[model samples]
Target: MKDTTIDDISLISIPKIKEVRGNLGVIEGDVIPFEIKRVYYLYDVPSDAQRGGHAHKELYQFLIPLSGSFDIKLHDGINKKTIHLNKPDKGLLLVPGIWREMDNFSSGAVCLVLASQKFNEADYIRDFKTFKSFKR
Candidate 1:
């Protein structure tokens, strides 16, 4: 098996109002390019927290740090990449067949995730050794 990485992270920013009684804007079909099927958030986690120790066979995910910062370790079977997510406007788009681990969360960090598919336990590859053998 090999260390894996995929290029799917993309930065997204939406204009927000800074004052009371101020108008906000929404660009139709511009921000959030994906059709979201589910919305979730990971919060109230301590420092050195670790999540997502599996690979999806047929699901897509977009991860964003809502409050603080964290590190995303991504693998795709042949390469590995670590991304530092600090800003709220930036998100990582994780495609299928990529293993990801979310760790090194700062205090009061809130992670927002959008999914393209529903939850399926069979779609997860949990064993790292099995993932090693799953490469092309």
Candidate 2:
């Protein structure tokens, strides 16, 4: 069974250390549930462009907006949610089997992603209908 409901999605708060010079954000092993196997980022997005029109079979991802802002639309078989990411110290945790689409990126927005697995095309459900069937 490769499925998790939308309720499984969660918000994660990264620990921040304040300083006079600059504030530092931390994403230690304890801050996230999984051992991150990959790190990537999306930037320089056009305002009308969108991303992530897919779902994973068994991958978990944590997405953070390092700069500017963006909106992520998530959907389960029966439920849907939209989340806005703006702060650098906050992130969204996406469990497996949930559909996700990203859009409305502010100029210079940088979306950092921490994944539990390395890039694998076989793990992705790129079609919404297939994703819905998978969730069942």
Candidate 3:
């Protein structure tokens, strides 16, 4: 596995169409680097609850806060970063080999995740100690 640093993380601007009555958000074309193969979302999470405590070996992910806000803590075995996401038109691009933890969600916050790969158990590094010792 490649040792992707926290500096590799980027915020992508999802396209938006402003209208008099309402606005529309689009995520097609090359907005996301990977071809989305799986889509999932987290909703109705408690404010004190936490999620995502693992790293992917070879998967790309784009995270968007569809409603409310939350904080994502990323680690790359050597570096760390904290990103607060709250906008609908903004998305965070996470490459492979980074440890991510999501928490501090506002009430009724919905986190939408677009994945480049399907669910694969072998592609995940669930333990932090193993993540630090296994991959480089």
Clashes of each: 9, 0, 0
Per-residue lDDT of model 3, residues 1-136, tens digit only:
5668888899999999999988899999999989999999999999999999999999999999999999999999988889999999999999999999999999989999999999999999999999998655
Q: For this target, which candidate reaches the highest lDDT against the unseen true structure?
A: 3
- Give candidate 2 misplaced runs (Cα > 4 Å): none
TM-score per candidate, in order? 0.81, 0.97, 0.97
User: lDDT (CA) for every model shown?
Assistant: 0.76, 0.93, 0.94
The TM-score, computed over Cα atoms with residue i paired to residue i, of candidate 1 is 0.81
Model with the higher lDDT, candidate 1 or 2: 2
Q: What is the C-alpha RMSD of each candidate to the true structure, in Å?
A: 3.5, 0.9, 0.8
Candidate 1: worst-modelled 10 consecutive residues by lDDT? 1-10
In candidate 2, which residue pairs get closer than 3 Å at backbone N, Cα or C atoms, i.e. clash?
A: none
43 in model 2: Cα distance from truth in Å? 0.3
Query: What residue runs in model 3 are displaced by over 4 Å at the alpha carbon?
Result: none
lDDT of 2 by residue, 14-83 (tens): 9999999999999996898999999999999999999999999999999999999999999988888999
Q: Candidate 1 on 1-136: residue-level lDDT in tens?
A: 1333575545556455556875453323646666788889999888867988998877777777878998988787777888898867567777778888889989989998888777889888999878777766
